[model samples]
Target: MPQEAGLRSFFLAGFECATQRRADGKRLDLLASTRHDAHVAKDYARIREHGMRAARDGMRWHLIETAPGFYDWSSVAPMASAAAEAGVQVIWDLCHYGYPDGLDIWSPAFPERFARFSKAAARFLAEQGDEVRYFCPVNEMSFWAWAGGDMGRFNPTARGRGDELKRQLARATIAAVDAVREVDARARFIVAEPSINVAPNGDSEQAIADAANYCEVQFAAHDMLVGRLNPELGGSPDKLDIVGVNFYPDNQWVLGGPPIPLGQYNYRPFREMLKETCERYGRPVIVSEFGAENTARPAWLYYVAQEVAAAREAGAPVEGMCFYPVLDYPGWENDRCCDVGLFGDADANGDRCVYAPLAEELRRQRVRFEGEFAAANDERMTPLRREAS
Candidate 1:
């Protein structure tokens, strides 16, 4: 298998690994609830057959660290061993918006505790081996702050503390990166944040100004991590390594209003958004989370993949794109079946129902890239590139 710098593959599968508390004070473990935790080895092997050799999975902080300082690797070991057994690489997410009980987000101990947890996780994974090292210390910091703090939809449920929560998350993330580095200096961190575009409804200058400001808010977490917004967070250029951006159909909108439908006149160009992100961060990027529901999956992949290709062609250091939530997961709010994965729920044999449309599209894209995706100077890839092919 070939690699592009820190990534093992140009395409990757991402498991839906969100573990958070809901508004009603109920905990949601999508991985265990979906039985993904039970079939990590099988899942990794199967996706490798689909031509992807890398994945993004998460560690359940709440589950692993049952007690304050004690941890049980029983929950995360199987996945790490499975990836190695299958010869697949992984990018692990340390804190996917969930924390151990009795840990207050507002307390001074939150950052310290999270950092300690990061060190423990890194040490354990390093013991597993040296092949798998990429990590997202705190996944979706901006979204977490908004959903959990501003909107009061999840843990750390505070109605008017979005900025405060964001700052806290940034501090924790920077601390985690440093902790992981202490364990393995070779480890790379991918700061996964969402990319969004907002526009004004009318011709009013104030409306345009408001929309622009709202649009820039999407970069707050990243900016803070890079010490551009909040230098007090201990963030610097070192903390801003690989940029992992999540984008979706609902990511764009009229500021403070309705969503801008994908492919419509009001929708902004994703290629431009990607380019701007690379320009702003000065790091290689990965579309860490992107997919649509049910029947729209294929079309969405096609659109996103093309935009990613265009971004690469335009000289943005886009390293890879991950088909997020490669396995279908239960919705957090309603427990509904979100048919947005290449594979549906597993059966008695631990086999999942394949979404044929998505599988076919994935193969088609994979074949094309494997046979035709060489760059001007990057020769680590196989087959001829676009112009040559």
Candidate 2:
């Protein structure tokens, strides 16, 4: 219970945990994958197997409460039950992107649909009692809208920022969170938003401002959802209870330097963000998602833990930091899967494969750190860090 320093994180897994691949070989994330329900079950089974303390599981409102008045959560319930039995805390995510079969973004019934589904889900879990406390009403609201509608990364791939999409998503999230609380007064939320960085190619002042605005745009929906979009150029932080920060080894840049390789980004910003978020919102923060690609993962976990500890010491209310997954799945790039595993891999015959050394080292570091982290180094406070694995 790192609750005192407000440090704790969910053990998130199953982005495509049970999703089957598209026939043409393209794939969608957890939400869009038709195999979501099955993958969720398998992932929950493994979560119990590992004795993980907390999990970031999702319940897509669009899927469960389609057709306005109809409700169908038969699939997600068993996983919630399993978590309760295992004594693991559940940080349920209400939406990760994607909508129902026939719903439009601007449908008049959108808010009510989300609210009803969220309340039902919450009541269902509350009846189970005590085990599920945390909730993420919507995961990465800005990224999803951008990627799906504007950026064309996922479904409904629309281009450019859509304020209407943003508002609809925020409204649904607010309604869902509010609905859940009605069922369980103790429900806590960690609203996740991907922290993106888009630095300029040159060393001009305009580049600096562009980079700052890039970051600001990433924070917009989160700001509005939290009730901070009005006064402070986006000064709302009410709908957000615990600011859910998702940083990755791939999410970084150089002001004028070469891009760091995918696996080499540092944890300095994570620490700084925790401190700043706590100071700004006066609420606990959660490193909802954090991990690296394919090398020196043990060291990655070690440094992340160290950074988390450092944030806590500095008076940042960090609730928890999560390791994305315990194992990897092959064919990740093919859209069938993504290899963000923390454990060593094995083949169909169960033999050790790539990243064996990294996995072993991760175990060692996890043991060595023993849930402890260091304070943020004052000399290293400036964002440009020199440390490398």
On TM-score, the candidate that comes out on top is: 1
Best by lDDT: 1
In order, candidate lDDTs are 0.85, 0.59
Task: Assess candidate 1 and give its TM-score to the true structure.
Answer: 0.93
lDDT of 2 by residue, 1-389 (tens): 22332322233442423222233435434533323344444444444433345677667655577577677877678777766655556677776664565656567577677777788888877777654377777677786676655765554555765655676678788787778878887777777877655556566899778767766676777777766663322224446677777777656665545554444543235577667666766766777777766564656766666777788889777766666644555453354444555433333433322344444444344444343332221112112121222
lDDT per residue (tens digit) for residues 1-389 in model 1: 11233677778999988888988989888789778899888788877767778899999999989898999999999998899998788899999988988899888799999999999999999899765488899999999999998999999888899999999999999989898899888888888889999989778999999889888998999999888988998988888888889988899988778999987897998999999998987788889999999788889998988898888899888888898889888899998988888877887787776777777677667655654342122322222111200
Q: Show the colliding residue pairs in model 1.
A: none
Cα error, residue 41 of model 1, in Å, equals 1.0
Worst 10 residues of 2 by lDDT: 377-386
Whole-model lDDT, candidate 1? Answer: 0.85
How many residue pairs clash per model? Answer: 0, 27
